[model samples]
Target: MAYCYTASIFFPSSSSSSSILANDRLPHLAYRPAKIKRRLSFSCAALPFDLSPPPIDHDLLDTMTVAGAKVSEDGVIGTFDNDDEALDAVENGVAVVDLSHYGRIRVSGEDRVQFLHNQSTANFEILHEGQGCDTVFVTPTARTIDIAHAWIMKTAITLVVSPVTRERIIDMLKKYIFFADKVEIQDITQQTSLFVLIGPKSDQIMEALGLADIVEQPYGSHKHYSVNGMPITVGVGNLISEEGYSLLMSPAAAESVWKVLLGHGAIPMGSNAWETLRILQGRPAPDKELTDEYNVLEANLWNAVSLNKGCYKGQETISRLVTYDGIKQRLWGIRVSSPVEPGSTISVNGKKVGKVTSFTTGKRASQPLGLGYIKRKAASEGDSVIIGDDVEGTVVEVPFLARQIPPS
Candidate 1:
């Protein structure tokens, strides 16, 4: 039986009917509106949404309700205790984070490989079953739509993307479908739950859970396992730590799996800790670094883009940027003296150079750290810059661990 689903696309609400076209900025490209505020809907065959698990109850844990601490938009706990304790758990021990908010889409049929290869930046044709690779979807002008990790399974390719971009990515994929192409796209997000184990002791915890083999697998590789009758697919990857593994399972098994991990000495981390960890790792977040405002190169996502691959959307723009050295700005790490808001300007010698995109207090250090896109010429590692007027900051390398002095 096929279930039908509808996704709504809402355009920007503005008084001006005039819209900016992509060709206006890049004359060689076909015209596409930069903004449209009308609400439109599309329908496709999908599994029942009811299959998704309900939001995790924070009351189940001895959570701390501090100011600025709350549930994430994705419905996961934002803070179990304090951010510092959470960071300590990740650095010195093991921590389990709920990532059920991430989206999962399954693409199947004989043409799946070729179709995905032409849709995203990664060379999907080279991925064999049980292997995975991170890929980015871009516009015709090479602007980022989203970054997804595709795991090749026996019957289909499972794409895990940020929750914010899930619907849009699915819509884009469906719109690109051709009548002669043998491809099927299904939203399996509701049917599955995703969680991550991070930190130095993550391997120990995995082994205790009877996933010793997964700890030895290379990044982007996964294996299936069953724990107490709950089927799980464990994948190796670095989400917020060098030692990290992701577990994907049915929604019905999520709670049990989470408890079992905690019972084995894994600290429960919430989004508050996640934000601090991600910023420290220099990993981009949805609607922050992974937006249309920046392209793949500017976002420093070269690892995810395959330069030698055949034509795909935005291939020309990416190639031109590389061939011409036209990347104006690049994402960088910043160590700030005090708290700063997103969109805070970064300047040097009284000149504006960049803007802070993501920031978090140093739960594991002395000051705040952030991610921003800076003009390549304006700053370099170890250089000092002004953030939002008089606040001073230093440009630093990402995975910002050098300055993480443990608090007294």
Candidate 2:
């Protein structure tokens, strides 16, 4: 006797599912009776496949808004009040900057170290558990990709990358994976949050939070801790300030941790304040100072590049530049007589020497300060240059604080 069988499948009734699946891919039930009188029927249901990102924590957003945070379009706090007060907090007291938006990725497996070593500019093979260092990802032609800070854990290495370059870096790393290599890359950016505590009082605040041990550790040293059932990892690093401590925790734990630090007198800082401080520190930021338009050396990120490291992407070009002094332009600090827009040209005697990448109204310095790339042969510290058309400025040493003190 012949038998007929049919199957039916149902997916969630949502626009997301409809957009994700095509009509032909959607299965339906069909039955044809033959000599047999009986027919079999099977039914299946499939969950909707949603490709949207997770929603932001509204509770945390509301809390910050209530606390007088000027939230940016990206949802980060831009400034609680003004940049000047935040600058003061960084120099005198502790200031907390939410860096949760930064990208976080976890690299696991036995070959993770060697895999990263071959991909980036740092010597990752030498790092031990609890150690971390900044590294740069570059193209084959030695153009800047992004500078990532890696924290070595017992089982995996956690990479903190720029939010803009997160997906690109992940895709780039995955493309290099081979069948013989044992490596896994997981993007944990949404799963975790990061905060940076800056200022001279950062150590004191850590002690108050019962993290005195972390404060004593050197830069790039991290230790994990469980605080009231929430897992948190504290690390020492000079991200924006000379004495900065980074706290990595779950999104759910961010509110509580932020409150705890605030209870200990940590001021809330925002992006405006961050930009001013970053320019003052002479730190290269993604798309601004760190970009494919310039090489890593030209960005003045030599500390992040390891000269003794083995072969890596763009290694040959980087080595040649160093050996032959091929780097023509170098990042420098410019003290402008007035505010100047980024992308403004820096000229000497009507000849184009460089262009500004970052410009900030010096609320702390009571002047306009900027960072840009200048031809090494055209400018030196204390050389006068014209910003834009007629705005006069002088080339100064980076970490602008070294050349002039911030006003009290």
Best by lDDT: 2
**Local distance difference test scores for all models:** 0.72, 0.73
Residue lDDT tens for model 2, 351-370: 99999999888666685889
What lDDT tens digits, residue by residue, belong to model 1 across residues 1-408?
432333332222233333311111110112223344443333212222234343433222223234233675546677776678778888798788877778889898899999999999989988887788888899999988777888887777888898789999999999999999999998877667788888888888665544565666767887654322234577887454436888876564455566567777888777778888888888877789878899888887777788888799999999899888898998889999988999999999999999999998877667589899999999988999999989899999886233222112
TM-score result, candidate 1: 0.80
Give TM per candidate. 0.80, 0.82
lDDT of 1: 0.72
Candidate 2 least-lDDT 10 residues = 24-33
Error of 1 at 205 (Å): 1.4
Which parts of model 1 are misplaced by more than 4 Å?
1-74, 228-230, 400-408
